[model samples]
Target: LEGLAGELGIADRVSWLGFRRDVPELLAAADLFALASEEEAFPTALLEAMAARRPLIATRVGGVEEIVTPGTGRLVAAGDVEGLVAALSALVSDPESARRQAAAARARVEREFSTAAWLGRLDALYLDALGQRAQAPRVAAGERPA
Candidate 1:
């Protein structure tokens, strides 16, 4: 990150805090959250940003598309710098629209990714797995199960 900052001639423009315990507070103080991962699986940072009610700009990769809808945030193709720039520009140019989108993102997170919702989904998945195992035909010792 330091190298990149120097290369971009914006060393003064960036502050790289290695690890932070106050992530929620930091997120809440931000105007926007941008995630440019090339690939990701259910990113908790994205969810945190959503929960923080910040407008988001994320690359369309992995579960990001499923989480960031049109009304909630902007989605750009992975590795598309121009698209990312446009997304940021749009949000910066339209504060009211950005706020509206931020609100929707927060609502979506609260409605679908809340602790109760996650726990309920996990319980359902475990139940389904157990049910499937129970329905499997019993096999004799030393015999292969079909």
Candidate 2:
């Protein structure tokens, strides 16, 4: 809120934009992402931001640390305003660095969590489980497979 309003100098331009229908497109068009969270499970927001290839400026908590590594974005200590400010400043001062990080983040997602790769791995797991079940022999009332 304050960060967005003050940093961007658009206090009045900040609209709620609640439940936007084209969030994906907006994220894709974004230059950077800033998330301040203390706890999270999967932090799908970070994943979504990464999927959109935007450099993140997130607090070092939850799954954010995993998402914003050296190659992805700047991870600041939780509740560290100075750190956040520094990161924001550095990124703002050097857009090239942010662009590189964003590209690397997208590449990382493509390598680790791409939909095609995820589905292929799931298929392999199912096949392996099925094969194991098939190879196992049924047991009689008082006897088991040797």
Candidate 3:
């Protein structure tokens, strides 16, 4: 909250919607989710915005790098105040761009991280015989899981 007030220079305009019961309403009211967090590991907040079809502006940190790709969100280096400001301004002034990015983000999440894909992989493994599992380790040939 202090970060926002300092960045936007509108500390008085800030509203702390802490523990709001109307999640959908709150999400719907927002055009973007902006976070300048220095530490983020698979940030659930950004993921939630993607799921909610809201565009994001976040610092490029950890798993956030993997999350915001192309049209999903705009990422700036952590502590780059000017860059963050520029991104926030651009998105705020152009609602259409925000919506487009939001749509694309949601689509990417659905295609890449959907529960259906998870279940399908589980079912495929279930269908595979013990011999198939024995034939090849699940590391995709030469590639190893990092």
Best by lDDT: 1
In model 2, the number of clashes is 0
Q: What local lDDT score does residue 142 receive in model 2, on the 0 to 100 scale?
A: 89
* Model 3 stretches astray by more than 4 angstroms: 1-11, 19-21, 124-131, 134-146
After superposition, candidate 1 runs with Cα above 4 Å error? 123-146
How high is the CA lDDT of each candidate model? 0.93, 0.83, 0.85
- Please give, for residues 64-102, the per-residue lDDT of candidate 3 as tens digits: 888889888899999999999999999999999998999
The per-residue C-alpha lDDT of model 1 at residue 119 equals 95
Residue 128 displacement (Å), model 1: 6.9
Each model's RMSD to truth, in Å? 3.0, 3.5, 7.1
Local accuracy of candidate 1 as per-residue lDDT tens digits, 1-146: 79999999999999898899999999978989999999998898998999999999999999988899879999999989999999999999999999999999999998899998899999999999999999999899999977
Candidate 2 lDDT over residue span 35-78, tens digit each: 87777656777777888988788888867666667878888888
Worst 10 residues of 1 by lDDT: 61-70
lDDT of 3 at 73: 84
Candidate 2 residue 131 C-alpha distance from true site, Å:
3.5
